[model samples]
Target: MAEITTHQLVKEFPGGVRAVDGLDLTIADGEFFALLGPSGCGKTTLLRTIAGLEAATKGRLTIGDRDVTELPPGKRDVAMVFQDYALFPHMSVADNISYPLKIQRVPKSSRHATAAETADGLALHGLIDRRPGQLSGGQQQRVALARAVASNPTVFLFDEPLSNLDARLRLEARTFLKRLQRDLGVTTVFVTHDQAEALALADRIAIMKEGRIQQIGSPREVFARPANTFVASFVGSTPMNLHTATVSGEHVKVAGSSVPIPPSARSRVSDGDEVIWGARPEYLRWSTEPVEDSIEGSATIVENLGAAALVTVDAGGTLIQLVVDEDDEPEMGARGWVVPRIDRTLLFDGASGELILDDTPTSP
Candidate 1:
């Protein structure tokens, strides 16, 4: 296993489009790191650059202790699993898994033995004789993973390797993949647009936007304490509700209602500063009567999700959402109050969209 590092990495395409822009990152040895972002965010371009499939426009690329910026894909000591499971249609499972060994000029008997061992680990033992065309989608994905594992490369690169699977299969594959990666302890770099997949599979994730990294942290850190408004809105299961408000002493005025700012955020802005107040759906509590430090709103929609209900309220012109227990479902068209959990509230600078740090009491 090897650590991958990049410094000032850049990849610019024709028409003045920059896919990856001056990214500085490091993936530790045996670490499972994920690159997550929306479509056209340059995650795939960065992965391709790491695999030597795409040349970097400018920067240094290193694997372990060697500089590999100019090296070709074959010499990078990395194996990639593509989204489409790029397996040979005519090759049997065993043959496909052992193809890397063949290319390295290993003896046929040794290749078969290694293939068998890898196949058994991935539960593909009985499908050795089947070709890609005859295998199920999940089975084919396993074969692809088996092939990649059989190579025993220093690093594994996965470009949405489970995107094509059904929801159930995807969950299963995620669990299996995590176990497999743990067992092998090889450094892995995964690229995906799925936030849940990244959160579930990665030890650390780098969220990207417009070819630049927005935030890098553990899943819980990113989800619970987003660095800025973009991350606060992007990483949650339900997008965070953000509204423009004016700071007044220790409180902010939201839709003509005064809401106390969390003690943690008290010193971030002056009394007249305009800031964005953010709260996740789960952090908002609903009540029929006006409550302390709450904004009154009219419930416009109520969606009954099996375990919980989503209550969307219109507070003046701003829309807010609250996730409540099914037993506490609110009636649509009813006027109610939505109170944010002060401890969990977030404040962002309106002009810059940057998080406003509380710097007040040193500890929470």
Candidate 2:
């Protein structure tokens, strides 16, 4: 396995459309990194460039210690798994997995042995004689993975390899993929638009937008402390609620209620300055009785989600969402108050969408 590094990497299509723009990143050796973003965010383009399927417009790329910026796909020492499971329809499972060995001119007997070993590792030995058309979607995906493993390349590139599976199958495939990567310890890069999938499978994730990386961190870091409003709204299962509020001394006025700012964010804004207040749904609580730093509202919607329920409260003009216990369900149209956990609140600049950091205390 080898580490991948890119410096000022760029990929510009015709008509001056830049898919990947001036990205500088280093993925460590044997690391399972994921590139996550919405559609048309240059994630796929970046992956293709790394695999040598697309040439870089400008910059340097290194795999291990070699500069591979201008090398063709075949010379990159990389194996790619496509979203559609690009297997030969007529070839048997064994033949498909052994195709890469054949191209390298391995003896037929050795190729068979390697194919059998890889198949057994992936639990595909029993289906080796079946063609792609005769296998289930999950089985086909396993075959594709086995084929990638058979090559034993220095790097593995997956472009949404599990997108076609059903929900339950997707979960199973995710666990399987994670285990496979751990066992092989190969440097891998996965590209996907699914945030949950990235969070579940990657050791580190780079969130991208408009060809530029927005943030790179562990899943917990990005989820708990988002770098900005974009990340706050994008990374969570339920988007964080944001509202414009005016800083009043040590407090911010929200929906006519004065809420104290966390001590960590006290020095970031001056009195009367407009700031954006952000709180996650799970961090807010709903109650019928008045609570400290709470806003009164009428319940607009209540959704039961198995073990928990999501409550939406319309406070005058703004809508706030909070999670409640399933046993204590709130009735729609009931008047209630929503209280935010001040320690978990986030503040952002109203115009820039940048997070406001507290200044360090001066030593006396």
lDDT scores of the candidates, listed in order: 0.91, 0.90
Candidate 1 global CA lDDT score = 0.91
Positional deviation of residue 126's Cα in model 1 after best superposition, in angstroms: 0.5
Q: What is the TM-score of each candidate against the true structure?
A: 0.96, 0.96
lDDT of 1 by residue, 236-325 (tens): 778898888899988999777889986667877898999998889999999998799999999999988889999999989788999988
Q: Highest TM-score: which candidate?
A: 1
lDDT of 2 by residue, 1-364 (tens): 4999999999999999999999999999999999999999999999999999999999999999989999999898999999999999999999999999999999999998999899999988688888999999999999999999999899999999889999999999999999999999999999999989989999999999999999898887777667788888888777898889999988999877778886657877899889898989988888889887888898899988788898988988898888888876789999988888887888888998877766662211
Question: Which of the numbered candidates is closest to the native, going by highest lDDT?
Answer: 1
After superposition, candidate 1 runs with Cα above 4 Å error: 359-364
Alpha-carbon error at 15 in model 2, in Å? 1.8
Compared with the true structure, model 2 gives a TM-score of: 0.96
